[model samples]
Target: MPGARSGGSGGDGSNSGSYSGDASGAVTVWEVVSLLGKLLGTVVALKVVLYLLRVCLAMAWKSGGASHSELIHNLRKNGIIKTDKVFEVMLATDRSHYAKCNPYMDSPQSIESLVFNSFS
Candidate 1:
């Protein structure tokens, strides 16, 4: 009652409802709904921005080459493949031979499925 503002009954035979007090004291129903909508919109906007940022970073990390030598060259240029021996080894081992999908991408690939054989 202290923070509530009650509206008189309208001519439409409907009683005007009262809203509860919020952190900013007494607030209307429309104000609460608007605030909730704004909060949800902000959250969704942030999620979309984050998703775009992740996609951009992934694209940046991608070597953009369809060959093992090019992939290794990109890795060495990016300083991931530090030494010559490591670069040679990586270049010698073709990812396409092992990875079935997106082998040239700078990410982990599931080369094969693990089969656990239990001995009774």
Candidate 2:
């Protein structure tokens, strides 16, 4: 009777089974929310994984860095990592290196040898 129904009257047969419209810009809104959710989750997960990897690598590379002892402490804070192997790595460093806590300590043949010899 009127030019068009207020609700677009699907049951009245005036309109098709479905409504035709982009629908008040809601499509864009929903897409933006979904994309933001996924992007945020991905970023958070990546940060956590990268942090764990960093800790693992710090466990390996500390002896070559300036703060070898501090790196051992950080690993301890993360969890129960074996300090003995890392200590051996520090021990195996060259004589001129300043990271060694003890200036008088002898440089071991290798980290492998130091670990074996210590436990033996």
**TM-score for all models, in order of appearance:** 0.43, 0.32
Best by lDDT: 1
Task: Flag regions of model 1 displaced more than 4 Å.
Answer: 1-60, 114-120
Clashes of 2: 0
> Could you give me the TM-score of model 1 versus the true structure?
0.43
Give the distance in Å from residue 3's predicted Cα in candidate 1 to where it truly belongs: 46
Work out how many backbone clashes candidate 1 has: 0
Which stretches of candidate 2 lie above 4 Å from their native place? 1-26, 60-120
Clashes of each: 0, 0
Question: Which ten contiguous residues of candidate 1 have the minimum total lDDT?
Answer: 111-120
Worst 10 residues of 2 by lDDT: 99-108
